[model samples]
Target: MKKERCDAASGVESIELDATVVATIRFKAVPPQLLEVDIALCDAAAAGQVDMYNSTPLFVAATGGCTGAVDTLLKHGAEISCSVLYETCHYGQAEAVAILLDHGAKVFANTGQQNPMCAAARPGSVKILELLHECGFDINPSDQGMISTPLHEASEIGYVAVVEWLLTHGANVDATDGAGKTSLHHAVNRRHSDVVTSLLDHGAQADIQDTVRSYRASRGKYDIVQLLLANVSNTQRNLTVTS
Candidate 1:
């Protein structure tokens, strides 16, 4: 029986649970010794200490650890976790991601509820998205950020392919952000016609309005009147029109 770490305990409190209970929190914070030792490994790799990332658990040949020290870690047998790799990959580090995958990092490692697939869409990296998919990532994971899915992130950022991939992968097309504004709401507010169209094609609510009045005012260009007319249900539309 193993217990996942919790913030409630002041110190290291261990619990015993069956594998299912332990399954969710797989990647606990590594020990300080490992972090320090891994730094040396990363430094060595950065200096070309390793030929390629190829080791189980990837502590060896991981060129990416702590972002800045990626190249260094690869030399000493340090494979980066999937989330960090995807994040850097989103920033266009194709070689870095390739190395991590080569070294046997799990593409499905959902890092703290933020999946690598979400990271790929955040930066609008089509290459990163493709690579992660090729490696078998869940394109439409339910994990979200502040009430937003990866599709919402891509739509908000005007990432066309990201939005497309998410829709194709079965992302909830009408998914709302923390603000309760749907993807279409974000696109229209941001004036991204392409994103707006993409979202609409996938059945995003056209008339979803910002519950926050201030947010609506912030987007002076958005026509709250027209949006309400087009997207609301006939019953609601009639009521609003009559009122």
Candidate 2:
């Protein structure tokens, strides 16, 4: 009897059920009716299967952005926490995230291996970002350790809206990551001209160099290099006049 594996990407595991049975319970394919039946038959059947990395029914449903499935699972006593929230944020499932939050899920749930705010930043959904903020997600949390703030992620990915929102909400424009690279450094490295411009407008320090390498020397994005240099020169001139 070969042990059946749940979706490897989901990191779920199941008992040695038949492959067909496992297939019927997949996150994408399982209808609400079938999910109810499966859960009733084996509430502890790992929902999709218990993997080292994946949680149960809630995590699986959230990952798929199946809001209906998530509702059903939550009603069935699925623990709402960071794991589920992180998955929904990663998939950009705003509706699922809303439902979870309505059901008393913690916005700052201990993100096991995922950062919920950081994940939200990548997709540039202002609504979700605002919702997380309303629920007490720090706009500039340093808990990410070496990963830096949501602003850094947004800037690196060229999410101008998210970057703007973070700045408006008090995210430190010059916060550095474990690599000592600020959001400006990331925006400059990626050559996201619009993001670089927005960061500068929001008071990001253009002259701050990263510990690993110089932004001006590493990439030859002439426009971006010129923009950074121009900002630095303007600031220096202002200081000289003030002195």
Candidate 3:
């Protein structure tokens, strides 16, 4: 009987299932093809050196965007712990994310990356973000880490499309992260002109609307603040001209 990896003796994490099997799973292999890797869907951690994820075959499948393999693993009770969903979102595997969600995966994963929303934002996965919203994820989850919301993450990386989508879906345009910086602040600091424009379209960007907050900028580049004030001036001028 081919036992699942979870059946291994208590707390053993080193690769139980062969790395080759995991590699196969990572490269888009599905069902019957997955037959050789143990039907039990092991919980073995195939550390980075070997499988590059230090996670289970399920996680490997998720990161690889192998939807069928992920479904197979979930059917066998593979653990969808924090890391699993987080890694899946980080990789922008929407189909796999849907599978995990259907399998009772948590909407807001609290992995090393904090929220899966941030992970998806890093890659500009708007489809995955939509899936997250459908599953009831908070559009503006408070940044318990580097970014306050997915919008901040998108703007920080200059994911212009993602920034626009997040705004349309109710993310606070002026929301701040732990650094007390809004999406506009991040966009301005990162020189993401397109993202700056997107944020301006949403609402007030703290460009000069009485925001008592800190700035995440180098002392040498305090000029970025001036640039923001200058942008606000341009916007006001445009608005006046249009009126």
Candidate 4:
């Protein structure tokens, strides 16, 4: 679904833009002057020229970590679409994301790139999430009609570092998506023991009932019910001691 939505930014403008320019950027070429020669190419599409499946020159440069092209394009008035940020996150390009944000790129949730924070979390780097945070993107980005917070994405994919980072950075451990299931529920269903432990340690409600989906233990190696009960016991003991 994410790939489909992100790919929606794709289209080609062969007459207005140079194929050589797109190729150079795609292959890691970084001379900014190649762009200066053709200022028309910078914002050829008004919205932002995209080729190779709807990628902007700025976005291509950022994706490949080519700072020069990124700078040149932005200076020439390239569109600062959130789609660029989304691609940078999806590609794990932290510096590129910072460049876009520095150029005043805001996450327009209504765009095709609906959930940039989700893309950041999907890449398994807390740094990208941190960059977005600088842009005022909270731990849980506001829903754009799509389900799953960044926490849910990381939890389902079993990225414990991402899960922990979100929890520390202001994620609601008990927050549910449109599906009415918390990140904890996702982890349990996906059988990510490490992620489940991280969520529980972060004070997720272990006793919260699962109303969306249920799963049976396929193998004895990991027991969901046992894990939840164990956390519940530890929580009660901690409360009693502190009381």
For model 3, residues 13-106, the per-residue Cα lDDT tens digits are 3234566666655664656555434434444242221454565677776777767667766775576776688778888888998898888876
- Which segments of candidate 4 are over 4 A away from where they belong? 1-16, 19-48, 106-113, 142-145, 211-218, 232-243
Question: Against the true structure, what is each candidate's TM-score?
Answer: 0.59, 0.75, 0.69, 0.72
| Total backbone clashes of candidate 3, pairs 3 or more residues apart or in separate chains | 2
Per-residue lDDT tens digits for candidate 2, residues 33-139, read 65555544333334445544445656766776767767766775667767678658867889888888888866455444455778788787778888788787777
Q: Predict model 2's lDDT versus the native.
A: 0.69
lDDT of each: 0.55, 0.69, 0.67, 0.69
**Model 2 residue 3 lDDT?**
47
* Candidate 4 lDDT for residue 31: 54
Global Cα lDDT for candidate 1? 0.55
Error of 1 at 124 (Å): 0.8
Model 2 per-residue lDDT at 131: 75
Best by TM-score: 2
Model 4 steric clash total: 3
Q: Candidate 3 regions off by >4 Å?
A: 1-16, 23-53, 107-113, 206-243
Off by over 4 Å in 2: 1-24, 27-53, 107-114, 143-146, 211-213, 217-220, 234-243
